[model samples]
Target: MGSGTIVEVSDLFQNQPARLSFQRRPVTEMAKIVDIVMQHALSHPNVAFSLTNSGRIVFDVPSVSEYDDRLFDVLGTQASGLIPLSVPSEDENAPGDERWTGWISSPDITRGKGDEVHLFINQRPIASQPFQGAIRRGYKTRLMQGRHPIAILSLKIPPHEVDVNVHPTKRDVRLKHSWRVLERLERAIAHTLHSVATAPDSNASSLGIESIKETKTETETETYKKPSWAITATQQLTLSGDSARSLEPEKKRPISSSPAIQKTIFGGKPIAPALSSDERDIHRYSGIESERPDSEKPLSEIINELPEMEPLAQLADSYILVQSGEELLIVDQHALHERIRYERLKEDQNQWKPQSRISSISIELNPKEMSQLQAVSSTIKSFGFDFDIDSQSMIIHSAPAILTTSSIEDFMRDLLQDLSEDNQRALSMEKIKDEMAFMRACRGAVKANDKLSIAEMRRLLEDMRCIPNPWACVHGRPTAMRLTIHSLDHHFGRHG
Candidate 1:
């Protein structure tokens, strides 16, 4: 009506109360509407986009000549941490094999949620499983399980090369000469990951952490500098034998914020905007939380079931080494905790819930995430989270007692994305419950580089003796490995 284009919608469900009853919360609806605007904003970075809800300026990002600048406008300081990517075409004859230009965050700059990887085609937002899978394939072994990197990549090709009409929503499309495109894209991404690392560019099988790691005993006190990428040392480690060990935190982490690529901040999500749906079906469900029939073993009995693995030392502050008979058992602390949490959750439905406590923090939401949160609100609440929503924004009034303010935002976003995928399919209640437990355990588990006492390590092993699948975590990664004396003797040429 004035100098610029103005689009407005008045009453949405004026007379359709029945239909309105089936709709999501007002805030969720607003998020979905705004999400459409944001997608168009990312896709058409040259076009100035502004949004208003109830006269409040939700965002007013100006047009920018460089798409990367637009990224800074929409993604805030998070854009600066990303590595610029330029993928060359593999072959001239192949369609959609044209070079890709975009930015992707490194493995350490990851989110608890998998929804941030945004992909596009020909300057239009489009989703393709093969493309998303290729991106993940590039990040393989580099990232911790359940953590996702933020990526915004786009492909350029003739419009005919991609069939956008395949999906009703048009977000997903069918591509021609896809295998060739995927192969090159995967290799390009993998090569980029390798090239960007500080160490020798190799697809290392065992990614030995180069960062400093420390373990403190109860009698010792020490001070250390904290890295920006380090996880909080919040867990209370188990004591060895009778006495307990306290895992005190530094309380303050000198988290270095990335410099802003541009002055304009995008909705304060320093990361990216909005979450889209999944690229594939639930990966390796394998009835992760199914009930296993086992004899009722007492806690002491379970602890004693396995051969005594006497606590030796915490290796590299990541692995725990123990002595059992003439063998050495190397246990991955993070993986062991993940499996322990998963088993505890699956053993009792009540274990899925953490103690609830009041916490007041408001979070900005992208429309897709808002919709997903609304879809799985019940399941989310079951895990001890409570939120109040309105068209203006959503405020968290309560959360699980185990989560700190620093982690609540991340954990919530992660669960929203994971549960949203589960909701897309017609899964059984058991399957859905199990999936939620799987994410909960993964989120709550201790991470690598976390310091654990010898006692704590022994307690974890003892707990593992009772778990049904103690060999691997819920993600199916090996938790512990053994090096028997027989094998060691053979290597040393010590024949009997």
Candidate 2:
């Protein structure tokens, strides 16, 4: 058991071969060697304990519980870096089952030969094709095509759900929900890639984009539409004011003698007795019809209704300048439009019940793709699509009202792509729904560079105010940002 001791041992084939084997040594010798190795490993608390031949011990002690820290310590000077991740649980009820873990170096936490990594799920380390594939996919962005990053992930899930009996060494575990776990892991890794690769930190220069100020104006030539009831009400109110004044008695009249004379004089206007009930009914009907169109109006009318602001010239075809008292307000046309569209879409979604319309054409998809679609059917339904899968093809019975005129094929394709992306992660249904809604809103909204009329700009502002998150777009990009006059003055060195 200790040093370079050679002893004869029987082989399974019963062949005589010279092999360095541990003979049935005295209990004292074995115990002494075990004590020495354990003491050595215990001394280096940061090192992983491993016993080698000749009674030697090799080990590494991890710095912290995080995958990256542990990996850095284990690899020492040879280690490249770490990709830390925390994958949230897919189940709503078992929210605590989220995995706070990552992958680690496998002797070769690098790109060359003997390069390998270890994956631990639920604290019980294990290696599987899908699990490893998930890690590879997640690091696909950071590392070169063939080169892989040395990573250590410590996955945390409900211990009871992971069966540790799958391997003799207990380095691998059989997850009860393999796909769900793998998807979560993959998403965590992808997110890590995005954060590392896409982040625009403070060091980057600004885009030099300025805010736009919306200047609302009313066209004098455009006649404002007045409903019949409003017209009638205005006329009646004016007439009532004149009649009430005229009918007031010049002085207090004696009630005894002049009652009949007062009544004749005080009576306002004689009712038009010649007009029959039928004629009155006809008049009412015409008034109702005339008012209906003006009452049930589109948003454009509402925008035009606002008081016109003084004309302010456009700057660089983006910002609209408006003077509010001594200060100038500039708005981003794209952000304003995005905010408006988001609010309108959200309001429409909440206020109206989803209405389905049957499609004449049936959409076809493969089984795996269909399964992915079915998984996110509720999310799809929220975005105003009700899909039914039949023998030959999938039928889109109804779509969102906004998408009514859009191509059904394009809608299906986009929906499928979204579903596919979501399926790659163990995301909550709520998160999935939000993502789908945001995607739809972004797709449907007016893009930047689209010219807007002054009235339209005003309407956009009104709509933006109505939205819940007006400061940012649906995807979390800032919709509009403000720069105070003081800051502008300081930039020009006037404040100094």
Candidate 3:
């Protein structure tokens, strides 16, 4: 027999004509190979690894004692920003059998895709949803939606307690007690991140927000002031049961369009003059029809349709508290605004015209993102986004009036991801527009912790009431929660 049982196979899939016909892009295939090799190499730290690309050494990893050393070698400068994670013996009940260790990137050091998350079980690289979800749960509110943290996780579980041959590619593993393991991993990551925040290091501030020096450009410094009108004061309401209280309408001055004020009303959304009625009707025949015939109905009519409620007060600068009949309504200001914006975008899309040319904005895209954008460039242009693709960048010559420059990149990235996933390339014209509108609404809506005045808050509530589906946001999340007076009394010892 040949030494080491050397073997070579040629004419791959020769007998399978169907499989040979479906050819994957070279870059895509290479990326999968790189990912697989990286996963195996990261787990097997004792084994040295080298990657060659077209006769050139692209990446090299030397054998090392500690896992973090390999991470540093692979990620290079990027690894310096990561926080080391370890579980204390007291915190881990099965420390000997189910050992865990890893390094997690800080919130600022994030990726647009989940490719950076490399998880291994018992020194075997595997992809486990529970593991990924657990890591995400650990980060919780620290990361923004659509952003993924770069992490390297190693779980040393007993071989008999896990099953590895379930998946076709053996990429996943099933643990005997997965829920408990996931929970432990999540807790460990959270605690590690917390410790990093409180480590008294100059690199990170409290709450794990990065402490870095930022250079502000002229465009960043220039403030765009949006003029907002306040609504007439609503009826005052009283809170009963625990402690009786009455809210008085507070008079506030005209708000300046400070960064804080603009961020409060809408995050990164540009303030532009309203489009004319004729302008809005340009896309009427493009499969998008107005949801209501009375689209131009008076604002007062919409407000009148809402239940007779008294605005009580604002909660945590994010929620509006209102008293209606015997129920107390807790409205999420952000979600409510998102629903309103989504409806408005829908209306705008129906009237969108191919000839409409908004100001052009240059957006920088990475190689992979750029390729994805190029793939669906024509589809995007049909939605009123006229862009010219360049190497690692895109120049938009025309776009919808509602899209903000700062948020255009994020919007496009999210759109490209949806279109590129699973090779589902065929999409209807209306569906594309709808997806774009949803992304725009999500990005432009007011974020949490944005302070709003009593009048502005009341106007927002009235606006939300006008939407077709005011109960839920665009993402199907509940916009408000109602607590009945009886329910409140039952919670306490008074009614029971």
TM-score of 1: 0.54
Encode model 1's per-residue lDDT on 174-213: one tens digit a residue: 8786765666566566656656652211121111110111
The regions of model 3 sitting more than 4 angstroms off are 1-9, 21-27, 44-81, 91-95, 107-115, 140-148, 158-161, 176-180, 198-336, 346-420, 423-472, 475-496
- Pairs clashing within candidate 3: 280-351
- Put down candidate 3 lDDT per residue, 160-250, tens digits, no spaces: 9899888888886778877667767776776676555522222222111121212223221111111111113563321111123344545
RMSD of each predicted structure: 17.3, 29.6, 16.0
Model 2 lDDT tens row, 136-207: 655442332233444545566787878888778675667777666665666666555444432211111111
Model 3, CA-based lDDT: 0.60
Q: Report lDDT (CA) for all predictions.
A: 0.59, 0.44, 0.60
TM-score of each: 0.54, 0.34, 0.53
Best by lDDT: 3
Candidate 2: where is the Cα deviation over 4 Å? 1-311, 350-358, 370-388, 404-437, 443-447, 488-496
Better of 2 and 3 by TM-score: 3
Count clashing residue pairs per candidate.
2, 24, 1
